[model samples]
Target chain A: MADRPPVRDWATDFDHTDPTWVADPYPIWDELRQACPVAHSDRYGGAWLPTRHADVAAIAYDTDDFTSRSVVVTEYRPPNLAPRGIAPPITSDPPFHQGARRMLLPLMSPQVIAKWEPSTREYCQSLVHELAGREVVDAATEYAQHIPVRVIARMLGFPEDDADRFRGFVHHVLEDVTLPLELRLPGMQELFEYLRDQVKDHIDNPRDDLTTALLNADMGGEVADLSHVGGTIALLLLAGIDTTWSAIGASIWHLASHPEDRDRLVKEPDLLPTAVEEFLRAYAPVTMARLVKHDMDWHGCPMKEDDWILLSFPAANRDPEFFVDPDEVIIDRTDNRHAAFGLGIHRCAGSHLARMELRVALEVFLDAFPVFHLDDPAAVKWSAGQVRGPRTLPVHIG
Target chain B: MVKIAIDSERCEGHGRCYSLAPKLVEPDDLGNGRVIGDGTVPADQEDNARQAEGNCPERAVLLEET
Candidate 1:
């Protein structure tokens, strides 16, 4: 057995699971960036938290040293997990990652996703219409979460009948960060089983969905088993469902707290695209992990093999080294290279789709309830871990 | 006479070039952009095309005027 590195004291010890960090990570992030750019955390069996944009971008680009093979920032590894790994592209590196990505690329491509834009517009508008009679709506639960799951499900060619179930599976795996990975493994296993059945069905029946496209793809070669396909679909669901909603929820949260911005958006609707970009940057959603492949000196910190390092895209967005006013949310901020969806080879495959969803969602939302505000500011609840956003936001929808 | 070009390798698919100057930059199937047509930037749309070049995150787009 390979010996684990001895634990050492560090300047900044971030406990991601802690509620304090979950609620408002910016203060701690600032402390770490100023004091310890490469701070270590003892929570997930000693993980490193990098608060600098350059360091995070370098690590992402240096796939050779910091691999995506084991992205979860924990020492926990299940014996039953496949040697090929949990999810393709996201979990894969180089040759394998490239091939797998090519196969999945068209699903979210401009032409393909453009075909779904009308329906996407319809979905967002319809959801807003449904909330017309409500006095107070939990905008996060009511609005932000509605459109993405259905759109992703339809795009993947999954039966619309089970879209709710699909959302349930996503919440179980991604949002259920209240418990450790050990406890969450059971739910993960269940999701894998469900995805496995879905992939098997696609293989046997041969539908005209994204699954069929992936099933018959010539990706330099082929996956040995259908389980790999199942893994890939599972990965999509994991990546797809929660991420955009977090941004959407955070957008509502931001607008609710800052009515001036909301009023401006309502008055000058043309600014929606720029507002979306700023929202993506200011409340950048996803934080990804990369495993240290070899024991080496990273910047000033002595990183060891198998140690986890969180490349906080949110933190990177606020990196004072790059942006002029890192903390302030400038809606029309140009020259913005924020890593909201991340960077490097494994940048979000569904980014175009995500951008479209956010734009349409906000556009319809502003049009539908231009005068809405948070009913109880104190009651807004946020979800922490991997994907972060407002889980519960009660708004007075006029 | 001039044509625009982009080194696709550097494209992180920011889509700014296309969004800013759609006449010059066209998005490929997955929304990663490329210079449209023989990559020609017409005289009327030259300023829009230049803005796109300035805004691309990866500096992928290139414009040459002769």
Candidate 2:
């Protein structure tokens, strides 16, 4: 983790990587939403956080004002690689983003995701089987973490045994935000090198996986080159894993802590879908960033060119202006228009997959062990930085 | 009778409408919500269709009376 100064005031000197914010950001965001909806921070080279749903949604939809060239706020800003930024679609702007995203949308559609459900459920059951006899299970590491890693690994045609390596790469990109460029560059380099090797393997021996599909993907009659293929692969691997993992881990953490919710879920299995949406609404794991296109006044804040906008869907989901009792978790909340999967053009491509995984993972776990609680609430450590969730969750299954 | 419609321009494919009202809406090839049977909401499914319209984050799902 980057050793930086602690936040003195959330409105002016807010840092998402700050210890206070990472520990639990709901309180910080709630405070900011009431006091300052658009909080500015000098850190990360002049970053802005829009805590309200309207502001975040406006930024997400306004492609002319903000560029998606770099969604992650790091020390080194990516050079203008518009149309096909560092990672196409997610990092690409407007006209190009749609085409780049369209290539992968069908692959992660509800129907495609449904096909993976049976296997995903089987995988979850196997994981539960492995942790059955254990009295104390670190659900985050033992179960939740492994689920998405395995699923994405299979999709990318990468060796599933390299799950730990993927986690290391994900940590470097998402969590290690405060690290200096020189230090952070190597981990990112290693990830690309690994991806290159996998692409090479797929080229040598074509298979029916996403990697192969990308290599042979057609972009408006033109085939994607190695760099485009590799960048898309990088996006899929990084974006797909940690986000869903956090959702699953956070849901498990919620159940472990709240016996009533857990009991209700166990008794009314049909309520899992509704409960899953509520969990997503309350504990949205992903917070995307965008760079300002030019100098402009946004909601009274004078934002400059290249300024980072920390578009927080989680904060928006909890805004009192949008939701009733935003802080409280209502498992049966039906009228939920939460932006957990985000809104506007850049809605999460893998949302359906993430939802399916969360539902299946929870269903399998609850069925296996209906009675479970936190082993040590103090021991639950959340990941620092943009994607927040319990990294080390100790649950007492027995 | 009530009818449901999804404006493609506004539907970013959150699929909330389809998830909340499966009988009334379904996701297309790209996962954007599409109304079932010319979007004519059965009398029995009016409540669900309305629920979906209210729950859409984009407010893309429109409830029309025929």
Candidate 3:
């Protein structure tokens, strides 16, 4: 009989599913970057992890071959889900994706995002006012979670009363990939239905918000994929809340632990925007993925079709080649160009909005509960690796 | 007289140009950048305009002296 080739083991060596690795991924990523820049694992049907900044940038830039059909390293997708793509431009490839993004991009343009600042500040102030007298605040739920949801809620034309439920849906699809498929399936179903109804509602009613704007968007000679619009809203709900929430929560956590940085910000309020960029650099919140369409050797690692590759923006932000003293949070850090919000065509459409929220979030929290410290930094529980941040941030505010 | 023009294809609307040289760079509704007033970059603000051009990640912003 002819000799058979040994089966390749994908899950060997790298284990992102491990809690220890998830808790502190920097070390794991560093180890991988040094030993194997293009690390592979069998976790999600043979996934690839690119730890270096330059390699990550190259893959993101080359959407021609390495497409974005699956934007998550671990696929929590339900059976019979459309093979085309899920979240509009994020999961879509070019031409189609380009038209879709151009159609939706104007809605989040800098001026439009800037216009929301007053209202975002208003929302932050109200939350601060409510937490004024409290010496203890669950900064995660109380402060961080509220800011973006309110802004997103306003954008979606959803009622404030529905915030908790929608957030639950967001958490379900985006965060709870670890949950059993049966448990996660219902939430996914509900989320799909909700977005579809919203799109339908806008098509009929046409209100004055993102939904209406997306509906009225000219597709620039391309046929409008209503499902793509629905997927865009779905993407908005899933993406909108947690990413900014994590950044805000993690920023406060950093400041609380490092009093000097906290006080520096309080004294030099003008440096808030600069500091916000640094905050994003130090504690970037998202790590998105791309699906391998064709067999290609990337950074010498053979990536097969159907394999998933994670572009760890967080790890990229900390690459020594990219940033000076990448670990330390240097407020007012200049010449800083970190890709907290992914790079290339799929670069975060909500970058401006996320930045505005972070600036206001920290400013409001500092004003409301000054001189706060983590009651037990050890007790801080992070979200399951996908959308990274504190699930419960307990702080003592004075 | 100097002028500013954006390689609309290259510009991803990072908005750094707007933040740096707001007087010259105007952000469209999608946040993609555009040069205001016939893409003219006045001589005095030329440095500021250059700064914007330099800062663009995509190098979409351009300076032209005509």
Q: DockQ of each model against the real complex?
A: 0.46, 0.84, 0.43
lDDT tens string, model 2, B9-34?
99999888998899988999889998
> How would you encode candidate 1's per-residue C-alpha lDDT over A1-398 as one tens digit per residue?
12233323334456565667778888878877888788887656557888888888888889778778766554464232423467877888876677777777766676677778899999999899899988999998889987788888887788778877887887776656545567788878788777878777887898877787777765667643576677788887768778988889999888887889999999999888878888998899899988787899887788888778888989998989978798998877766666787887777888888888898888899899888888998899888677888989999986
State the lDDT of candidate 2 residue by residue for A306-339, as single tens digits.
Answer: 9999999999999999999999999999788989
Ranking by TM-score: 2, 1, 3
**Which parts of model 1 are misplaced by more than 4 Å?**
A1-10, A78-84, A177-182, A221-225, B1-4, B38-47, B50-55, B62-66
lDDT of 3 by residue, A87-199 (tens): 77787787667787888787888778878999999999998888877878888988899888889989988677778888888777776665556776788788888777877
Segments of candidate 3 deviating more than 4 angstroms: A1-12, A75-84, A179-183, A221-225, B1-7, B36-55, B59-66
**Model 3: DockQ against the native?**
0.43
Docking class of 2: high
What TM-score, to 2 decimals, does candidate 3 have?
Answer: 0.89
Q: Across residues B1-66, which tens digit of lDDT does each residue of candidate 3 receive?
A: 778889988777787788778899878877878788887777788877877876565667788877
> Worst ten-residue run, lDDT, model 2 chain A?
A216-225
Superposition TM-score, candidate 2 onto the true structure? 0.98
